[model samples]
Target: MEKEIDFEKHLKNAIQEERKLQVSFFDLVSKFEKKISNFDFENNSILISDYFYSGNGQKNIMKSLISENKVNKENCREYSTKEGNLKYDFKGVYFFLLDNKPFYVGISKGVIGRICQHLKGKNHNTSSLAYKLGLLRYEYLNNKKHLGKRKELNFVTEVEPVKQFLQKQKIAWISIDNDEELYLFEIYCSMKFKTILNSFETH
Candidate 1:
């Protein structure tokens, strides 16, 4: 047989492909939780598949969100965890509903920072709703979306149908973020959209 495949190399390459988003996270979550009981994923990354799979989610999320048109796998970009560093990256909007409203678009560079800033009204770009909520920054993540732990940064950016799918499927919120920033991103996205949604619901 040929030499063993280089998993890390494959992951680095996968980071740039939307197909990575198609992983069966439910199975992974159950497996991860079984391995580490009481482990919270919503606030973490879903890139726990050894290491190789981690690489692919990053670039793909970015490419998916930013690209208006679906990116061709042939034209995707390759990246690595060592090189394409992302400490605080959440550069896309999450669309959703609260009480049957439509349209809630917002973006962030630092999911945690942005949410805090929004609550404090520090950033002008933040959704106005975040300010009125009077919530503080979150260091401890309670819970997030379905694939909370596994979500990579580029998913929000690269995957086009995510928000639409969420909206269509009537999910409370759909989000995207970095390797370690998914929870914060989910919080920010929900906060942003919550206002738009709740406001309409009350009015």
Candidate 2:
């Protein structure tokens, strides 16, 4: 016998884990979406890295520049838009790939909340257009709005239309990080690969 393993128990655990990951991934994508849409960063022009760092920090900034600036912005969320102790406005970049075909845009907001908006919609998040398009699912349990989000949106639009860029970029890694500053820094590596992967695929 094959040790009469408890396959049923294993199956249930697997299913639970899968569901958990699904929710978590959805949450991550949802945050990225919110950042891009909320700030309209699909139009980013300047890709300045290390603007916020100093001295030795510049090294980390350079390392993070790869995937982090494909989509860059000053601010990407609002304050006092929701109801709660919410009070944090972040400035950072959203990443997109342009391997001759733009796929999707993502980000790692230096603060919080905005990314969820893009994946989820504005003035009506429970039913944003992106949701209708069958993109990302709901991320945070509660919704929020903050200052600088509108300004960030303007900054994003000033760059270039992301929808139009779809033909240029192949894929993108979008996200917004609030847990650890280092996590936000790591997204740049993901960005580097997005471009690198596209190069390999195109050839």
Candidate 3:
């Protein structure tokens, strides 16, 4: 009789704990939504097609031909404003939008640098979304069960199609410095926007 009573008490306590956690989670989500409501994402966003087009034609040609090592080296240069003087580096979450609908959300310590990777990156580690899109659209990649193994993938041909697709998309980001808040807000935004490409899975 005592053991039965103890189990009932434990179950009640567990239920209470779960309820508290759910309440806390909803409260935190509300706070995050309020904070994000003020951000001017549309005005702040950069169009991938426009940004790259602003550069010289020769530079674009060179960028296309350059090795990934050279591309990474080029990315190491500080991000700048249109005036080409002020440098801005930030840690935050970024969005990939197609036809004004968000498809993916990602967080990085260097948001612009990360965006560059998605735009021009040559491999799976750098351009994961493009790789995933390739897997979905290409029959060759679709047949390969080991496509997740980076070594088995052929990035050279697969990446260009998705890269062009990404160029048509728009990017927006907001700075969030606190690591805890950054991660939580990413989850919140991903859920709120119903981003199709985002997978909050552990590797």
Candidate 4:
């Protein structure tokens, strides 16, 4: 008889090992660069495989280049940003993708609350005008601010036409605990993707 494998137990063990490896990897990487430097941890993790490590080559190449340049104040300044702790409790960074390209990149301890603020436009998350327009409920469109300079307020004015543009959008995210690291990663993603909705200068 074939022995039954405890898949759930196996997965739990594998997850624990991955956690240990992740911590060790972060510690080692931190030795080379400042803790808040822009490193894409999630995508890099996905590139690793059982046959060969994809990230190792890239990491080495980057390290060599950085070594030649010498990590300096300017480099650190370019990558680091300071942000306040989130009021909600869903720690991670997220991306709103439109047509498979990043439309906006942001980080928050409370993903749902932050996303709500963006869509609902109640908490000064007006930067994501595209997202807000797409997700705003019909009931909330009464405000003239949402209508903009259009003098003619019409019947059935949920701005349904604008909503169509945001179709085929998707969201991707990775959990991050450290606020400084989260800020750095978000900045990095914004710069990499060049998301029009994100104001990188502000972080």
Give lDDT for model 3: 0.68
- Candidate 2, residue 176: lDDT: 36
Per-candidate total of colliding backbone pairs = 16, 36, 0, 1
Misplaced by over 4 Å in model 1 are: 1-89, 95-97, 100-103, 122-203
Poorest stretch of ten by lDDT in candidate 2: 132-141
- 2 against 3, candidate with superior TM-score: 3
**Which candidate comes out best when scored by lDDT?**
3
Better of 1 and 4 by lDDT: 4
- Say which candidate scores most in TM-score: 3
List the global CA lDDT of all models: 0.34, 0.35, 0.68, 0.46
Q: What would the TM-score be for candidate 1 when compared with the true structure?
A: 0.21
The sequence of per-residue lDDT tens digits that candidate 2 reaches over residues 67-165 is 475433333344454454443444443343343222333333332233334322233342222332222111222243223332342322322222232
**Candidate 2 vs. true structure, TM-score:** 0.23
Candidate 2 — number of clashing residue pairs? 36
By TM-score: ranked, best first: 3, 4, 2, 1
Better of 2 and 4 by TM-score: 4
Deviation in Å, model 2, residue 61 alpha carbon: 3.7
Q: Is candidate 1 or candidate 4 better by TM-score?
A: 4
